[model samples]
Target: MRDLYSFIIWILSYQIITGQDPPREQYNISCHKVRETCMQDPSKSVPRCIENYMRRCSMIRTRTPVEGYYTRDMSDSRPMLETEEGIIVHISSEALQKSRTKEKMNSNLIVSLVNKTFFVTNSSPEVVYGDNVLGVWLGVKEISNLSEPVQLRFINSNQNENVSCVYWHLDQNGNGYWSTEGCSTNVTNNEFVCSCNHISFFAVLINPKIPEEIHIVRLNYISYVGSALSIVFTATVVIMFLCQRKKHSENSIIIHAQLAGSLFLLHVLFLCSVWFSDRSDQVCTTLGLLLHWCLLATFSWTAIEGFHLYLLLVRVFNIYFKRYMLKISLVAWGVPTVTVMICGIIGKYTSVYGKYAIHEEKEKSSNTSICWITTQTVISYITVNGYLGLVMLFNTVMLAVVLVKMHKLRSQDVQIKLNKKRLWKDWVSLLGLCCVLGVPWSLAFFTRVPLNLPVLYMFTVLNSFQGVFLFLWFLTLTCKARKEEFVPSKGTLNVSFQSTEEHITTNVVSNMIQKK
Candidate 1:
């Protein structure tokens, strides 16, 4: 009895040390014989018999299956066990053969490993019609234990040819959480390989990068700073125009004030929406619509400025337009509102704004966002760019015509010939006017070229400071005119007053003499 006990202990120790289980038949026979011996012998302990049975059953449970074949379909219903060796996948030969006969060649295989089950798919696998079945190799490197191998079977669904073999395991959140940051994938022959350094629930992903996530961080910073400055300067311009209302009652000042007010609202709403877009979709959409309206209004006002300038400087004789301000206000505000309403209605049924593909790469793509006109929709192109294009063209034509007229006037006018300094000053003033009126928007034509960065920088800087430039131009003109009117020479002032009084006295005396 002592020798038998020692022998059993030694055998158990040997199995543990080798990490191997005894043969299934041998284990079953030993349990059966032990039960029979305990039954026959009255001295045999009932507890000992039960212990031996449990020990043999455990050995049977841990044993690796001799048959290595598996099919993805069988994994759904089959009982599975997780072991130190890895998750054991077992499929009968008949089941695998039957699965291959199905019409869809592409099918996802579920592989149970440790506490996780992974979905894997093969690139391309041949379908066999008959009983001659070939085993597919599936290699899974368990996140917990890297040494052991887990096998799985897959069918290629042909859903996406560019699907990566690697899958990211995700945690359950309100929305399913998944990422491919650390996962690796490889394919060889009939084998699908997936490996990860850490453990999680994993699955295959197609086109994994979300558009909102692309370049959002960087763009947010640029937009915030630019918009903030624009807001400040635009507000300043509006305030200046309001404070100096009595001094400068020209239509030009009123137009500038309107433009400045519109720009101020645009920048404020843009800054708010860009920063807090994720809080509520409705808010973002509303802001986007408002921005669209303001943007159109701004360009419309710029075009009106050009038209007003054309009448003032070019056709100086017929400078009067009946209710010109009212006409311009209707066109500037009404057009954008109508266009925005139409766009908003159309956008309700379709995607008008969101991420878009700016460029494509072999393995990836670059994407950009247009919050108001999210996508590159036809309506967006026509309404936004088309409208802006027409405005820009009109402004450009007016600018050219004004410049030509100024050149002819400078050559022919007696006043201009007498003062070359005035010619130089007029050129400077014209340049300043062009900057304030968005002539730099023409640089948008060069934005697609290789030198786009510089052009974009110049465009951004000039447009952002447009309010500042307009304000400075107003200040300079006001100061210069005021100085000319009030700051006169002492001698010139005395001579002018004496001449005016003498002429009045002579006219009164001559009238009295004629009456006598």
Candidate 2:
């Protein structure tokens, strides 16, 4: 029992870092059967942990080999060597493959360790300057062991030539993959230098034989872009709000500012949860769903305003501000609140509702490292997006009708004999703002149907810019002090009351005169 416990503990500690059992020869007596033996031990935590790690790791490392055992020194750290001409970064294949185990490791797992040494002169550029910088890379392909071709792309931020730095295929053995031009290339000019700053790259293993080939796999680059845009958009909205504050009505200004601030906060929260924490947590998952709901609600409220104006102007209905004030509040606050709660509950019980691809990444992609929601069932994902699309569709149609009505009214009023046309101007401008901001964001609910980076980026860019239009037309274009010309007939009411009082007084005086 003691021996079993000790073995379980040892495996747990080792798996925590390298994330897998390396070579069977290193353990000698077969650590694969350790779980079976350790299950009989007094405690179950350590053995269970080992089992979980192995299950998760095996799903990811199917094609990629474990490092260290096949390549570089694994003693303490990798070696460092320097040269006057350029930098030398050495990574052995054996060490890499040795550490590749059947355990779930972090994306931050250093797949390859390098001995880097630079000895450039002081006057030389930073890329060539003397500094021993470790170049760490993830997902190094076992090029020598694969049949079809593979690529090892370098970081090319400058958009220079030599874009195809590494490309290779099997010679004949059908047992290996190789890099054609080795690893490093010398650059002549500073303009075309390859560095980690501006460019990011990935490797692709093409044409895997038969049923095991992983296709349609995507990376979490969308999450990266979404998060980045969220930050930038948040900042832009904040600046615009500050600049345009004096031009708006107090109520409209407050609501617009709150909307901007809320969006900024929501995105920031998402950014942190995405890049820093796990999306599987109850809090993070709920918050992520809430952010989306908030975005939908924001546009939904704007559409409501447009529809309300259309009813008042075209249908000739009284714009009783009191009657619809509560409705506006309900649509703005109630809908999103309910949605977020429902999503949270679903995420808690089933894996479908709040599992945003930004945070809840799959343990095993079964192919490429794609970051998407792996629901307990696929139908649930379809259902959620379907519902969102429908809601957005309804709002879009309603607003479109409102805009058309406003245009027609404007054309009709233009021909009529009126002085200022103030009503026409204000109402039309409001409708225009609604169309501009709400249309693009509404389009996003459908565009993200296929779920990809390009679409995601396109949507993000559009949605982010919506804040600008929102501030410009809705919040910054109107003045708070100006009263509308359409106030009820106060002068007519007062005159009628006075006339009735005078008639009563005259009747009383005539009665006295008759009595006299």
Candidate 3:
């Protein structure tokens, strides 16, 4: 036992001293494999498979001219050029000597650059800037974490671009993504430089702007906590609803179940977003589409709730669609699915969904990442924010009309006595109804960039655990329904849905509560 423990401790210490990941191997440039992957149609394969290309890469034809470069002298610098003068890599003499001595390398060094001219990056999280990638290889003895760093100087073509140095990092499946690990960037008016402890494919990527307010950080924490709580509560609601489905299979009950179902899915997808985004590949895109569909479906159901209210309150004489539940379910679920599919197809060419970086004001680099629609894309505005605005408009109008009618009916009625206790209950009912129809979603518009701390906090708190409130509403209405005296009417939904103005004015909330 002592021997086993001692060996485990030794291995752990060795791993920590050498770093968690294995040392970087000398990256060999395979022109044939790269050209084959890059030449394929992007639509025919995973977008990542054809992301980057090698310029001036040529087959070993007897007639073809030389394309790549090689060197042995440690002091000599190399310029990778196809037509215009491209990137210039300056290897420090001290670093090269150190590497050669460490690896016992007597062989020549190889260098090349891959630029954005042929390397498409529309599928990537970060936008590729004008700076090209610098690749270095020494004969197969691998070396990493050099005591001396290698410096790559970049020509600043677009000085206005907010940029950072990144290296191509491959995952377990050999899929490549950009990372800033083991590297640093220095920018000047005319040129920028990337200094890395190890050599790999390096480039500059444009950084996206993110909400910088300190409260935004707090809101993120609130969102995560709220979503987690909602997940637990929503699962409980869903289980309960399913258990009582047969007993309460009315139109209003059906709508409540559907709304609960959508919210449950939306919250779950939102909470697991970061895990999907870490794939830094296709999984992130797929997760983004699913999340967008869930959000839209929730919105669609809220609007349907308003429509149900209109049928019950305004058109009291008759409330029948030939197949009410079926038709509404088709609309609520189908519309969002179609819309998100279209966006996903478009995203295969443009960056519509994937991992998004969040920037902090106090730092020069992105400090956080999440899976979401890219804010820079116009689709985010038209399909998400704009869609929410329309839903909010429709739901707001319906809520207003219901309130007005309730007040008018109450004023004309003489049977019901107004009391403080009754008023408080009415307020609670209205708040619960807001949760059911997602009226608090209007807070999303106010929570946009340049976010107000108070409003943002309120929005997160109210919307995050929406399922808890929804479940309470369900429980309260169920209890109230059971408490009433039993009377089975012979009339159809049309007659039962309607009430004389006198009865409706007795209690607006009682009239609007879901039918069991």
**Across residues 1-516, which tens digit of lDDT does each residue of candidate 3 receive?**
999977766775444233232122211334334434433543322212322222223223234433433333343454222223455565555456544645354434555544444333233234566544555654343445765677777778777435677777644333445667787888888777778777666777665223235656777888888888888888787787776676656677678778888998999998778555678567877787788899999999988887887776677557777988999999999999899888888887887887765542232444456677864447877777788888888878877876787676456543333655645655666676688778888887664333344666888899997988888877776554444425432211222221122123324444444222
Over 4 Å off, model 2: 1-265, 278-283, 299-303, 321-323, 352-384, 413-432, 435-437, 445-457, 479-516
**Worst 10-residue lDDT window, candidate 1:** 115-124
**RMSD to native, candidate 3:** 13.3
| TM-score winner | 3
What is the descending lDDT order?
A: 3, 1, 2
Lowest summed lDDT over 10 consecutive residues: which window, candidate 2? Answer: 117-126
What's model 2's overall lDDT?
0.38
TM-score-better candidate, 1 vs 3: 3
How many clashes does each candidate structure show, in the order listed? 9, 32, 0
- Residue-by-residue lDDT tens digits, candidate 1, 332-369: 88999998898888778965543223222112333232
Give all TM-scores, in the order shown.
Answer: 0.51, 0.40, 0.55
Q: Which runs of model 1 end up more than 4 angstroms from their true locations?
A: 1-223, 353-370, 413-420, 487-516
lDDT of 2 by residue, 1-516 (tens): 999977977776665334243333233222233333333432233323233332223222224433221122233354322222232333333423433445622212222221111111111111211122222332322223322222222333343332222222222221112221333333443322222211111121121111112212222344455555656665665665555555533233344455566556555655554453343555555555655565556655554544543443345334456645556667767766776566556666655333333221122332222112334233333434554466556656655655565454345444321525645654655454453335555554443232333554556555555544444444333332122123322212211111111222222333335446
Ranking by TM-score: 3, 1, 2
* RMSD values, in order shown: 22.0, 18.7, 13.3
Error of 2 at 148 (Å): 6.8
